[model samples]
Target: MSMTVARRPHRLLTMAPAVLALGALFVIPAAPAVQKGDDFLTPETTGVLNLEPGECFTDPEYSPAAGEDIVLYTTCDQHADNQSYGFVHADDGPYDRVALADFGWTSCKRGFVNYWPGAAGAELDYYPILPTAETWADGDRDIMCVVYDPRGELGGSMLPRAS
Candidate 1:
């Protein structure tokens, strides 16, 4: 009697597409279905002081007069109150608050578009907190840019995903 050995088929090629699609489906749900909240500002934490790219935060009652910004960090999963998109800085020397505001508006808007392409389709809005005259006098030159949905709160990062 002669016996033959059978080899198992390669599951990788067949399963690869399904695995990627399943991953995409799981990730897609996190982006749009975030719940909005009335409590906008998050509690102060050290995370705020060291904000990084793609970090989400909140400072609803933000006030430059209160000294350094106290941000509350939160997961971008579907409960994000606000998101920090980018920052702009003033060139060396003194700049008027008005000029600074103008620059902030322009710079933040550009940052917003680049960070979140959704803005182009009216899917998002942006705001820039420019340094106040008092703060500017004290050498505060950072302009923080934020991306938010005016219609309601979001639950995820506004940033586009890598293909």
Candidate 2:
């Protein structure tokens, strides 16, 4: 199960269509009342920023121009489109698309390795959800690292189990 990695820029106009088609775009909305480590028995629409590590969700519908995206949180035991592996924070600086991408790439790759230490050969792929300039100005600096199986839905949590 080797890992495949890809980077998905957040809300860039040029890449918006590709991001939406890949279900990588997450909408901004009133934060959902979900706590970290909670299991979502049923799907619920929420902003991407609301997602926490280990949470599983369906691909969200995003309107780039509207500055919105929606992800449906679901149980990891169920088949889902993507999972939140971890998050990275951009350094304190003016938003530079290229700089952000580079930071996200390096951070996400490192996070992925730490998250799945022995799963280097896992059949998984990952990408980062970076903040757009608008979102950055609005004080959104999170880069979410998402893991998914390119072939289809993830049937269960990829986190290694405790012995």
Candidate 3:
């Protein structure tokens, strides 16, 4: 007498999809989401340096078209009289959805990072940052200006501080 055992290889394959979906579901909860919207600045709104309480503009540092990149000079100060702290500068991109922290002349931990604005219909995306480091400590600044490169392409949309 002889006996045979049948193995279901397709069962393993079918399980693969489920495992991947399950993993993605868990990852979705911890990620930041970005949204797309209109610009808060009008062409008539001049004097970005003398902006009002809820005003902002994009100061172009670098710009690339088609096959070029643009870096921008940005300054954000919640306090409108002196542009002392809470300032960020990104000299490396016309990139989409990249945020860089300006650490000044030192090799501070800075780099492009992604952020998601919440409240409804959230999304998952990424951006750029400069000098990325984990052990960075705040050196005395209440407001920090991050060079925002929104994949949503809403870079000049007057984003507020992350609360």
Candidate 4:
């Protein structure tokens, strides 16, 4: 006499969504604390002079206005609400606020798309942290490209997701 054997079906595709949901929950605890303000120059922000490209941080009160002190810096993989894509230098001599603003706008706009190719129409937004007229004369000409989520607070790096 001979016996027949039966095989079990795999549930890989059916389990995908559940696995993804569980994986996402891990980063939820790392979310940065959101701070709102009337303007970006709120006293709540601690001044940080040097923030390198790919660095991540949280701005309790983020302001697009130039000249404000840098905000608190945090780990990109940990408690980061925002990240810096890159820095662009301004034109030499006769530092002008208007010209700097225009340059920052153009540079940041280009850099944003480069860093986040799939960002078009997404909830993400970016702005440039440019030197104020006073700071510019003091030799501060770096324009920092910053990315953040306006819809809500974020807890992890925004880089890998774009890809």
Best by lDDT: 2
Query: Residue 37 of model 3: what lDDT?
Result: 22
In the predicted model 1, the residue pairs found to clash are 78-155, 79-155
Q: Which stretches of candidate 2 lie over 4 Å from their true place?
A: 1-46, 62-69, 117-122
lDDT string for model 3 (1-163, tens) is 7978887788868899899988887774533333222122111223333433334334322333423322222343322211112334435433322233223312111221222344123322221122222212322221122233232233333333668
What tens-digit string does per-residue lDDT give for candidate 4 at 1-163?
9988785666888789999999998765644433331234322245545567878877654456744445667887666767778888877889776777788878888987877787855767777777766677677778777787765655677776542
The C-alpha local distance difference test score for the whole of candidate 1 amounts to 0.65
Mind sharing the TM-score for model 2? 0.62
lDDT of 3: 0.31
Candidate 2 on 1-163: residue-level lDDT in tens?
A: 9998887655598887787877744655654332221122111234566788989988766657656666768888776878888888877789897888788778887977876665544566677777777778888888887777665677899766777
TM-score of each: 0.57, 0.62, 0.19, 0.61
List the candidate 3 regions with Cα displacement exceeding 4 Å.
Answer: 1-3, 9-11, 23-163
Q: Superposing all C-alpha atoms, what RMSD in Å does each candidate have to the true structure?
A: 12.9, 21.1, 15.7, 11.0
Clashes (N, CA, C under 3 Å) per candidate: 2, 9, 23, 0
Q: Candidate 1, residues 75-94: lDDT per residue as tens digits?
A: 77756757778778878577
Worst 10 residues of 2 by lDDT: 34-43
User: What is the RMSD of candidate 2?
Assistant: 21.1
Residue 110's C-alpha lDDT in candidate 3?
Answer: 29
Error of 3 at 157 (Å): 17
Which candidate comes out best when scored by TM-score? 2
